[model samples]
Target: MRIAALLGASGATGQKLLPLLLDDPRYDKIITLGRRATGLRHRKLEDRVVDFENLAAGFDGLKVDDCYCTFGTTIKIAGSEAAMTRIDHDFVLAFAKAALAAGATRFAYLSAANADSRSPVFYARLKGRTEEALKTLDFADLGIYRPGMIVAERTDRRWAESLLFPALPLLDKVMIGGLAKFRSIPVETLAAAIAAFSMQRGCGTRIHHWQDMVTA
Candidate 1:
């Protein structure tokens, strides 16, 4: 049996991912530390609400074998680039730091498809910076899932995303080889893929995309 820690268990993808780990016989325990409770119960789950600004007390003396990070937000919803980075980048790195200190060896992070640290796009750069920061930690395995637009019924859905979601299937058909990574993926599939990646133990950093997740 193994122990796992999950951050952002309240989010769309994370919410779906939580049950997979809880039901899987391999993971004897699933610890979730987040700003809000996931509101779901499982025999294997231990959910805790904590302040992201101060995680030291929350993770004190905790030990987890693997950690999953699926928390993220948008610039529009955050109201500014700084706020967005605060949640997506700063908070993410903070969790990685706390998890590492708590003896986590494997870390799985959910990132954007075209994240580039040097990109002019704020969202992509934030994701890229977070990914880079996570690598500096001492995790033996770092799984960075760079999934494209996630398709799901979100309560806080963006106008643009709602308009574009209907066309994603048509767009996906034409997104052949190089563009395959950018194809929109369903939230359920993304969650399953992340869970699959978390189940594997290995060394070095690995990045996954649409094809990889679908096949996982």
Candidate 2:
């Protein structure tokens, strides 16, 4: 039996991943931490309500084998770059630290493609920084998933992806090789990859690129 903790069980990927974990008998318990109730039902699922700002304290008295960090936000939704980093970088690090303190030895993070510490993009920078921070932790295993354009049905429109998704076929044709890596990867694929990767026993970090995620 394995104990697992999910940080963003209500998000697009997290929501899709929940069913997989719940269906797996290998996971005896699953602790979901989120700002609101995920409305998911499972006898083995335990929900912990928490805000990102106060997550360290909220994670008290909980430990697991694998800690899945799927928390993320956009700059537009987060209001500012500082706020976005706070959640994407700071909060993520805080949770990882707290999880380690609680005896969790494996950490799984959901990052994005093109995540680089020296990137000109703020979101990518934040993601890269978070990944770096996770590596410093003394976890036995660290899995970082850099999935491509996650295709899912959301309540609101993400203007950037909304416009880009339609032109993916044409873009894929021209943007071949390393440059055209951002394909319309379904959310379910990314979720499944994470679930599959976390179950494995390994050491160090595994960076799953967008191209690899689509194929996985």
Candidate 3:
């Protein structure tokens, strides 16, 4: 049995993943740390509202076997690039550090496809840097999931995404070989993949691209 910690249990991906984690027999406990309550009740689930800016103080002494980080935001939603980075980069790293301090040995992070630290794109670069930062923590197992164009019903709507979602399947058919990693994936698939990976006992770091996630 394992005790699992989730950092973004209120988001779309997190919402999908939470039920899977709850049903999985491998995890005996699931602790959710978020700004707001997950509004979920389960015998194995423990929901804790937290201040992301002061995670160490709020979450001190909290320990778990595995930690899943699904927290993220867009520049538009965050109001500016700096704010986006605060959530995507600063908060994520802080959460990882806190989780590590609290005895988490395995970590699973949600990153975007083509996350290059050297990339000029702000989002990609920030995600890449976050990934790089996570590597330095030296967890027993670290899984970075880089999925592209997740298909799901989001609470916060983006017009561009809504318009482009319909064409994703057509685009996916042509995105073969080297471009396979760009193909859109269902949110459920991604959630299952992360859950499966988190339950595994392993060592070293693994990056799961689109192909790996869909197959998992």
Highest lDDT against the true fold, candidate: 3
**True-structure lDDT of candidate 3:** 0.89
Q: Write the per-residue lDDT of candidate 1 for residues 1-216, one digit (tens) a residue.
A: 678988888889998999988877878999998877778877888888898889756687678888999988888889998898889988888888888888888999999899889989878888889988988889899999999989988999999898999899899999999999999999999999999965677747999988999999
- lDDT by candidate, in order shown: 0.88, 0.82, 0.89
Alpha-carbon shift of residue 140 in model 3 (angstroms):
1.0
User: How do the residues 1-216 of candidate 3 rate in per-residue lDDT, one tens digit apiece?
Assistant: 688899888888999999999998888999888888899889999888888879775466666788999999988899998999899999999988988888888999999998999999988999999999999996999999999889989878788789989899799999999889988999999999998875567747999999898888
At residue 2, give the lDDT of candidate 2.
85
Per model, how many backbone clashes are there?
0, 0, 0
User: Where does model 1 exceed 4 Å of error?
Assistant: none
| Candidate 3: residue 90 lDDT (0-100) | 96
- Cα deviation at 94, candidate 1, in Å, is 0.7
Query: Could you give me the TM-score of model 1 versus the true structure?
Result: 0.96
The local lDDT score (0 to 100) that residue 91 gets in candidate 2 is 87
Q: Which is better, 1 or 3, measured by lDDT? A: 3
lDDT tens readout by residue for model 2, 41-87: 88999898887777777668876788888888888889999888888
